[model samples]
Target chain A: MSSVLRFRDLTLGYDRHPAVHHLAGEIERGALLAVCGPNGAGKSTLLKGIAGVLRPIGGRIERMGCEPRQIAYLPQAADIDRSFPISVFDMVAMGHWRSMGLFGGLGQARKLKVFDAIAAVGLTGFEDRSIGTLSGGQMQRMLFARLLLQDAPVILLDEPFTAIDARTMADLVDIVKRWHGENRTVIAVLHDFEMVREHFPQTLLLAREKVAWGDTRETLSAENLLRARRIVEAFDREALECTRAA
Target chain B: MYDYLIAPFSEFEFMRRALVGSIALSLAGAPVGVFLMLRRMSLTGDAMAHAILPGAAIGYLLAGLSLGAMTAGGLIAGVLVALAAGAVARFTALREDASLAAFYLISLALGVTIVSLRGSNVDLLHLLFGSVLALDEATLLLLAVISTATLVIFAALYRPLVLETLDPGYLASVSGAGAPTQLVFLCLVVLNLVGGFHALGTLMAVGLMMLPAASARLWAEDVTAAIAIAMGMGVVASYAGLVLSYHAGVPSGPVIILVCGAFYILSLFFGRASGLIRLFSGRQHLEA
Candidate 1:
C-alpha cells in the first residue's frame, strides 16, 4: 500500500509544551491503525495535528495526496454541546458540508444519501427529533451517521467509543471496519485495548514519545506496555525544550 | 376601550412612532437574542448592552442627543468589548465569562462616569430610559432600516451560524467559515443592540431582546421556532407596553420590559418545552 501520511519527527502541543514528541512514522493508505496509549499520552493531540486543527510545534505532517478537506476528524464527545437547538437530521446532514459548502443546496440526491446514512445507523424514525432529546447512545449513532456522510479518505476518531453503550459501540465499530474495507485510511485513538486488538490490524503505542509502531501483535506486548507506562510516569513535568535538529 | 387603546395610537403621532419603532426593534433584536441565549451567552449579551454605554455617552456629550452620533458610538464600543473579551479568553488562562464580566464592569463604570460628567439629571434619565414615545422621523427610519438589514444578513448567515454555535470544533475542521461566522454573528448582536438602544434605552434594551428570547426557549424546540416565537412575543410585549404606558402615564421603556417579563413568567409555568407544568407532568407520568 502507498503511504498516505508521513509524520517526520512531529512534536505537537499547546503553549510550547509538547504532548506528542519526536513522532516519526508513515501511515499507509487504507490502514486501520489504532493509537493506543495511557492517559496524557497525547493520542488526541496527534489526531489534532493530522486533522490540521493544530500547527505542529516542530517537525511536519505531510499528507501524500489527500487534500485538507479529505480528512474527517471526530473529536471527543465532551467537545460537542448536546444542548444546542438542532434536529438530528440537520446535524447528520453536516457531513455533506464538504460538497454542499456554506451556500450549496442539499439537492434530492444528497438528501437521499443523508436519509440512507441515518437509516443505516438505525435512526430512521429519529430524523425530526431535536438533538437535545436524544440519549447518549442515540447521539453517538447520529454522529456516526454524520461521519458516514463525510465519506472522507482519511478519518480520525478521538475516543469515539467512550461512554457509549455496547450496541452503539458495536454498530460504530462495524462502520469503522467498513471504512477499512472501502480502502479508507482510518486512525483512531482508543483506550479499550481489547477493542483495538480485535479491530485494528496495526497499532502505534505512545507515552509522551513513541514506544512502538508496527503490527498490533508485536507492538502491544506486555514488555512494551510496561515500558510505555514507566516512560509516561517518569516524564519530567519541567523538561526544557528540545534543541535537537529534526 | 377603543378610545383608551385604539384612539391613543390613531390620534397621537408620537404613540404611532413609538409603536412602529418598538416593533422594528423586536423583529431584529428578538432573533439576535435567541442566538445569544442558544450560545449560552445571554450574560455576555447583557454585558455588551452595557458596554455600548460609554460610546453612546460620549456621543451624547459631543452631539447632544443626536441619533447618528450615539448609534455609531455604541456600535464601536460594543464591538471593541466583544473583540477584547474574546482575545482575553483566547490568550490568557481566564475563562470567557470571567473576562467578559471584568470588561463590562469597567465599561459600565466608565459609562456612568461619562454620563454623570456633564449631562443634567433629566438628560441622564433620557439616556438611561429612552425617549421612545418621542422618536422623530430620522430615528424611526433608522430603526426600520436596521431591521431590514438585520433580517437580510440573518438569512444569508442562518446555516453557518447554526453550525458554528452547535459544534465550533467540527465546523472548524470542515470549513474555514467558523471565525468569520462568529465575527458576523457578534456584529449582528452589536447592530441589534444599537437599534434596541434607540427604542428602549441602554438599561432596558436588553430586556426586549433577552426576556422574549428566554420565554420563547421554554416554548420552542428548535432555533428557527425559538426565533420566530421570540419575535412574535417581543412585538406583542411592545404593543401592550406602549398602550399601557400611554393610558397609565408611565414610562415606556420599563413598561415594555415589564410586559416581556410577564410573558416569560407565563411561559415558565405553561410552556411545553421545559416549563414547570411539563416537568411536573412528565415526573408524574414516570411515576404512574
Candidate 2:
C-alpha cells in the first residue's frame, strides 16, 4: 500500500523543549495504527503535530495526496469546552465545515446528513439537548458523529476512549474500524493495550522516541512496554536542548 | 402611570434622544457582550472600554469635544491597546488578562490626565459618566449606524464565531478562520465600546454591554436566545432608566446601569435557567 503520512525525524515540543523527539516512520494509507506510550511520552504531542495544530521543533511531517483540511482531528475531550451553550445538532453540523465552508448554509440535504450521523452514533433523541448537559460517553458519541460528517481521507484521534464506558468504547471502536474498512487512514493515540492488540493492525510504540513499530502484537510486547516505562522514568527534567541534528 | 412613565419621553426632546441613543447602544452592545461572556472575556471587554478613554481624551484635546474626533480616537486607541496586550500575552511570560489589565489601567490614567490638561473637572465628569440627554443628531446617527453595522456583521460572522468560541483548537485544525474570526470579534468589541462611550461614557459603557448579558445567561439555555434576551433586557433597562432618571432628577447613565444591575439581581434569584430559586426548589430526578 502507498504511504499517507511520513514522519521524517520529526520532533515536537513546547518552549523549545521537545516532548516528542527524533523518530522516523511512515503511516500507510488505510492502515489502522495505534500510537501507544506511557504518560508524557508525547502521544498527544505527536497527534498535535500531525493535526498541524502544533508546529514541529525539528524535522517535518509530510502528508501526501490531501490538504490539511482533508484530515479530521479529534482532540482529547478535556480540550473541549463543555460549558459553551451549543446544541448537539448544531455542533454535529460543524462536520460539514469541509464541504459547506465558512459562509455556506445548512440546506435540506446537509441537515439530513447531520441527522444521519447523529443517529449512527445513537444520539437521535438528544439532538436538541445542550452539549453541556451531555454525559462523558454521550459527548464522545457526539464528537464521533461530527467526525462522521467530516468524511475526511485521514483521521487522528487523541485519547478517544479515556473516561468512556465500555459500550461507548465498543461503538466508537466500530466506527474507527468502519473508517479503516472504507480505506481511510486512521491514527489514534491510545493507552489501552488490550484494545490496541485486538483491533489495531499496526502500532507505533513511543517513549519520547520510538520503541517499536509495525505489527500491533510485536510492537506492544512486554519487553518494549517495560523499556518504554523505563525510558520515561529516566527522562531528565532539566535537560538542555537536543544537540542532535535532523 | 402614562404621565410618569411615557410623558417624559413623549413631551421632552432630550428624553426621547436619550432613550433612542441607549436603545441603539443596547441593541449593538448586548450581542457583543454575550459573545464576550461566552469566551470568558467579560473582564477583557471591560478593560477595553477603559482603553478607549485615552484615545477619546486625545481627540477631545485636539478638536475640543467633537463627536467624530473622539469616536475615531477611541476606536484607534482601543484597537492599539488590544493588539499590544495580545502581543504581550503571546510573546512574553505575562498572561493576556494581566497584560490587558496593565494596558487599560495606564490608558485610564492617561485619559484622565489628558482630559484634565485642557478641560475642567466638569468636562472630565461628562466624558467619564456621559451625558445621554444631550446627544446631538450626529451622535444619534452614529449610534444607529453602529447598531446596523453590528447586526449585519454578527449575522454574517455567527457560525465561525460560535465555533471559535466553543472549540478554538478544533476550529484551527479544520479551517483558517480562527484568527480572522477572533480579530473581527475583538474589533466588534472595540467598535461597540466606542459607540457606547458616546452616550454612556467610558466608565459605564461596559455596564450596558455586560450586565444585561450576565442577566440573560441566567435565563437562556442557548446562545442565540441569550443574545436576544440580553438585547431586550438592555433596551428595557434603557427606557425604564431614562424615565426613572427624568423623574428622579438624576443622571441617565448611572440610572441605566443600575436598572441593568437590578435585572441581573432579579435574574440571579428568579430566572428559569440556573437560578437560585431553581436550585432551592429541590425537584426529584427524572427516571432514565
Candidate 3:
C-alpha cells in the first residue's frame, strides 16, 4: 500500500496567511512519527493543516484512500472547557455523531461502540463521571476513548502528554505502543527528547522549518541537537543544571 | 380576592386571552432561555427584546393590517439588531456584552422616537408597560403559532446547538459545526421575542424569558435535564403569574417576572451548584 498521508510543498495557515511553509513529506502506512519543535514553531499549524482545520495556502495535501470519518484527533486536554456540564459518557459518545443523525437519536449499535471505546482507554468505571471531576491523566485517557470510538486508521495528537505528570506520559506511551502494535498510523507533537529516543522510531525536528527528519538514529546528529537547544542558551545554565541534577 | 381570581377566567374573554397567550409564551421561552445561558448570549436576548420598540412602532404604523404583520416586522428588526451586534462582537475587539448594551440603548431610544413621531402618547405607554388583560383572539393565535414553531425547530437542532454552545472554537475549526449552531440559536431567540411582545412587552420580554432558565441552571447537571425542568418551571410560573395578577389586579408581565425572580432567590438558597446550602455543607466538611 502507498503512504497513508502525503504532504508535498504544503503550506498552511489561518486567515489566508501562511503559518507553516513548503513542507514536503510522506507517512508510510502504520508509521509512528514524532514532530518536535519549540513553542510556536508552527508544530500545531502543521497538525491543523493535515487535519483540514486550517486551509493549506500554497500546496496540495493528498490524504489518499481514507474516509472522512476514519481520522481521529486527540487535542490537548486544556483545550476542552471543563465548565461545560457534560459527563465522560457524553463526551465519548460524541465521536459517533457523524453516524448519528443530525438530532443524535442514540441507538443500541452506537452505544456499544462508545462502551467499547471507553473500555479500550481503560476508563471502565468513569462512564458517568463529570468532566470537571477528572484529573489531568484521566482527561487525557477520556480523549483517547473518544478517538477510539472513531475507529480511524490515522490519529493526529497535539501535545498529548504535556503539563500532565510523568505517570501520564507513561500511560500515553503505553497507548501509543498499543496503536503501533495495531499497525495504525500515529502522528504526535511532543517536547521530550527521552521519550522520542525510547519509543518513536521516526522524528521530525522543526524550527519554523524542517531542520531534519528521519529515523531517530539519523536525527540525533550534533548539529540537529545544537539547533534544538539553541533557544535555551539565553538563560543562566548554572542554577538550571543544579536544579536538573536535584 | 376569590371573585377576582375566579371571575376573570369564569366570565371575561379578555382574561382568557391573556392567560392562554401567557402560557404559550412562557413554554416557548424556556428552550431559548436555556440556550442563551449556555451560549453566554443572555445579553443578546436583552438587546433584541428592547431593540424591537422602534420596529414595534413601525409595526404600529403598519398596524391596521393584523397582529401577524406587526409581529413579523418586529421579528425582522430584532434579528437585524442581533446580527449587527453578533457580527461586531465576532469581527472586532469590542466585547459582546458591551456591543449588546450599545444596541439595546440605541434601539430603546429610537423606539421612543418612533412612538413620538407616530404621536399617540397614551398608546405608546401601553406598548412599553404591556396590557396583557387587553389581548384579543388574534394576538393569542399569533403567540400559539410562534411558540409551536420555535419549540419544534429547537427539538430538531438540539445536539449540534449544545455542542457549539459549549465549545465554538473547536467546533468552528476542526468540526465546522458552529455555523449551523449560530443560525438556529439566534433564530429561536427572535421567535420567542416575537411571541413575548404580546404579553410581556419589549421592556419585560427578556426578563421573563431569561430569569427562570438562568435559575434552572443552578439546579441542572446536563442540557437535557435542564431543558425539561426549565420548561416545567416556566409553565408553572405562567399559571402562578396569571392567578396572582387576577386576585391582586396587578400588571400581568411584572407579576410573572416577580414570580420568576422569587424562583431565582429560592434557587440561590437551595439549588445544587453554587447555592447557600452547598456553601454551608462544604464548610461543615472542611471543619470536620
Q: Pick by lDDT: which candidate is best? A: 2
Which runs of model 3 end up more than 4 angstroms from their true locations? A14-17, A67-69, A77-79, A228-246, B1-7, B64-66, B169-175, B282-288
Which ten-residue region of model 3 chain A has the weakest summed lDDT? A237-246
Per-residue CA lDDT of model 2 for B1-288, tens digit only, reads 889988997899998999999999999988899999999999999999999999999999999889989999999999999999999999999999999999999999999999999999989998898899999999999999999999999988988899888888778888998899899989999999998898989999999999999999999999999999999999999999998888899998999999999999999999888899998998998998
- The Cα local distance difference test for each model comes to 0.90, 0.93, 0.77
Candidate 1 regions off by >4 Å?
Answer: B282-288
DockQ of all candidate complexes:
0.71, 0.68, 0.34
Cα lDDT of model 1 by residue, B88-123, tens digit: 999999999999999989987898789889888887
Q: Write the per-residue lDDT of candidate 3 for residues A159-183, one digit (tens) a residue.
A: 8988778876786688788888898
The TM-score-based order of candidates, best leading, equals 1, 2, 3
Candidate 1 — what's its lDDT?
0.90
Q: Interface RMSD, candidate 2?
A: 1.4
Candidate 2: misplaced stretches above 4 Å? A237-246
What's model 3's lDDT at A199? Answer: 91
